[model samples]
Target: MSFPEDPIACMRSLQAEFGDLAVLEEKGQRIAFVFSPELNRRVLTDPTNFHSRFFAVRGGRRSAQRRVTSGLLSVNGSEHRDARRIMMDVFAKKVLPQYHETIVGMTSDLMADWQTGQLHDLNEEMVTFMVRMTGALLFGITDGEYSEELGTRIDHWVRQNHRVGMGALVAAEEYTSQYEQLLQMADELEVSIQDMFRRHRQAGNSAQRPDVLSLMFRAQGTERELSDEKLVGHATLTFAAAHLTTAHTLSWTLFLLAQHPDVAARLQQELDSCTAAGVPDFAELQNCTYLDWVIKESMRVLPASSYSQRVAVAPVTLGPLNLPAGTPVIFSQFMTHHRGDTFADYARFLPQRWENAKPSAYEYLPFGAGSRMCIGASLAMVELRTILAVMLRKWHFQIESGATVDGRVIATMLGPTSSVPSRLIAADQIANTVPVHGSIHDLVELPSEARTAVVRRAA
Candidate 1:
């Protein structure tokens, strides 16, 4: 029923009308939209008949879209489970931790060169930084060859992808161009990743290969290898998902901080007390509690994908509603995250809500719920904390006057519109000096003395 062209507006309407469930009917096709946390749990947790319809596209030729759904994101069944198992080894707990150094290094390098006190397009800068980070860590692309070109294409692709479904005229011309460019960007990304895969496969020594690419080779050894086309498809999904999701989340975090200077001041206090004034060490990132809450709150207020879907292959009764077979069930993280009964002042930007609060299983799935929940969820935490900590340690920022932070939904992710703006001041330049301190979780914060003590103890 909500026909607003803007994604944010459309989502607001959907949240208002349907507390737990609302069916979106367009042209006589009813897609069941479920906002209740309990129902969302059942849909995500039960995968047997409620699997993703990877082939479904909006206003498209269905036949042409079959190829797109062949990757891990779209496919399900024993095969999907097996592939996920293989990926678990690569993106697993132990393996993901190793990238912390690389992540910290990448973040520091970017912030080191950032120019403060200027109106910069936050989305574009974030995409560049994210693409570079993914290239080096996730896909194993050599920096010299792909870094410059990847930045260019990612910016173009981000713009094109956002243009889709913006309005009638824009949708007509822009959607097609954007879809074509997205596929092209996929192709470009795959070619680069393919070279890395080929090298890792052929190399006799495992030590030389980066973790993810080597994991792909190992999966191949176990007869888990995807076909060349499927490999490219998987790589494309990883690139697009990893890059934009992180970029959008980080942008939103910054936007939130800019909007609430008091929150920003408190955050700086936490960061200064928790992390050293230089680059983040592993311990420092783990110790930044308030930073974690801020990121979680930001994700809650504006999740990357408002609605996640699954197609019902068999009839099932979900609470009060008995959905028929072939029903496409949708769940909104944005709606669920803002449910006032669960959260205080649901619309406000409040990180403290999570300080002593824990919602039920499906209530706040910034990352989707259940088994199909984002594989990158943990990795995202590390990266977000690392980048936010390092950036805050180095720079303090504010939004430009009279500018409002806005969002647009691109395929599977949310991002700022073309002209979103902000201003930055390097932390060293700021007059305020607040010592960062907090409780240590899995990560610890080490002072300079502690660093020396550890080194001395090791020696």
Candidate 2:
């Protein structure tokens, strides 16, 4: 059968037709698709049975210039464990507290550029903000110039990657061109990472900052002395994964809040109660329970990493079906998150659902679970909560009437197809407006004065 036009719909159709473990032949290759949480857990947790090399190649081959540029996502066995352990030191709980001040400061600096009445594509804006933040955290690059440059390049690469899937049969010129461009960007990025490494080395241990780069440098000559290739690979993966996923999550959360004013108002109230003049410290940010629920619900609705892929390393039984070695296995966060059995009123945006019910890791694998779980999950959460808290406190947003906000799968993550067009009204201006609760449809009908304010400021 020809590949379905809508990938999401295709997955649903397959599940409906063939049950949870559906096998399909595409382009002369046999692949297994899994939807239930149990199978997803088995595929993700049992790396020995299902290897991640397939997903790693999703970005294309490792650069030949680097002998060992394969990052943790691409590697398996002892190497994966060692690299993950070394990297975890930088993202450890203890180090998270140190990043709080930096993250808040970054959010403030980004917000400073926002003009009250001007229309903005929150999706694009969030991507820019996250690129800068990740750059600082990963490489100690305070100036956003390099980060912005990298972000633009990465966007191009991601778009191209999505467009040109396996590229085994279709050899279109556009695909070839995009693939070349992607490789060139990857090369440029590697050079930039090497420059950062060199600069960090020259500065020496005494002058080193507490960023991820510094931590990696400290590991040199030790058992964890990652090869230059591995270092570059880690840096590239972190830059792409860290910013893209978190930015998408933030954008979705903001959009959901705009659609659900009652939720936004309640979230803001919680923020106001815990924060001083709208700024929350790390402890206070953690205490904003409703804000956490909003984020969780947003992710549940539109996950950043939509789906994950693995290839069977050896003949294995997945549920009732037997799969041969080299068979590709697929599991989707989008499907699992929307499962009716796991989430009631799955389509509705209800943060309250999480207040009492807690799903196990198998049920909610937004960042994946077990040994191969995302190492940056902690840092990503902290960044999301802190950024959202700061932004929600400062502005009330309204989605542009008639504008479409839909998910477009780009590479591994799902983000807006285009700009999530919306207008930002300064919180002080809306503080006096009557609070509207319920569906975003209701919230879009702003008072005449508020509408006038938006137009007036635009003028």
Candidate 3:
């Protein structure tokens, strides 16, 4: 069978064609695709039987460019455990509390330039916000220009890998120029981070900072000691993964909120009531139950990563099928998340589902459930809650009419197909301009020029 153009449709078609476990031959390689939650759980949690090297290779081979060094994502066994342990404190519960102010400050600084009635690409805006936040939080870099440049370089590197069919199997030399550019950007970023470390040390304040680079430097002599090469690898991976995933999540959440005004109104009310200072601390964010539900529901509908894979290290049983070693096993979050058994009215956007129903980790694997689960999951959550709270409290967004918003799987992550053309209005002005209960379609009347601009850009 020919591969489906849409990744989600491809997976669903495979599941329906071959039931829970579908084995296909591609380029003489037998790949097993698992759909059931039980099999997926085994593949993710039991790393010994189904190893992570395949997934690591899949992530490492960006645009036919192989990674120079192995980070936590690519490493396994004792090395993975040690690296994870060392970096644990960087995202630990104790240290996250110290980052609230910095997160809030960075978010506020970005939003300060946003003006009411200004047409903005919601996806682009979120990407910019995340770039700044990730730069500051990861390397202590606060220059917006530098952050934007770095984000652009990363975007180019990521986009190079979005090819399909024979185009995806081009010679290594084809990617050399782009790959070298990415490496140069990484070199510059590492130099800046090292300089930040030096400044912190000279000022005798390195220990007081909550940034990831500082934490890494402080743990140099400890059991989690990471060499400079490993540090570069980890920092690059962290910056790319943290910002890209969170930005997509935020974009999808805002798009969904624009479609459902009642949900947005309730969320704003909850944000207003829960956060006394507008910016919420970790505790205050945790108390905002509705906001948490909204984010969770949004992730359910459109997860950042569409699928994850693991290769069988040895002979293993997945459901009724027996897989030999060297078999690549895949599990798709995009398809399984929408299963009828796990969620009632699985297709609808319902935050209330999370209020009373508790789904198992296997059933809802947004972050994945296992030892290899996303290391920065906690930090991602904090950013999502804090940023969403701040944005909803300050401004209300209305998606422009005639603008299409849909999902496109780019480099394995689900993102908007086009720029989400939207108009930003002050939250207070929302009452005078558009009824709180009005549909988003009724709120914004785009000028003909603006509509044409959006359409041309989308095309």
TM-score of each: 0.80, 0.87, 0.84
Name the lDDT value of residue 372 in candidate 1: 78
Measured with C-alpha atoms, the lDDT of residue 55 in candidate 2 is: 27
Candidate 1 residue 171 Cα shift, in angstroms, is: 15
lDDT of every model, 2 decimals: 0.65, 0.73, 0.71
What's the candidate order when arranged by decreasing TM-score? Answer: 2, 3, 1
In candidate 2, which residue pairs clash? 259-440
The digit string of per-residue lDDT tens for model 1 on 141-204 reads 5572475465455445434434542322223453555565555554555455466567645655
What TM-score does candidate 2 reach?
0.87
lDDT of 3 at 122: 87
Q: Give lDDT for model 3.
A: 0.71
Give the best candidate by TM-score. 2
In model 3, the runs with Cα more than 4 Å from the true position are: 1-5, 54-69, 158-204, 429-459
Candidate closest to the true structure, highest lDDT: 2
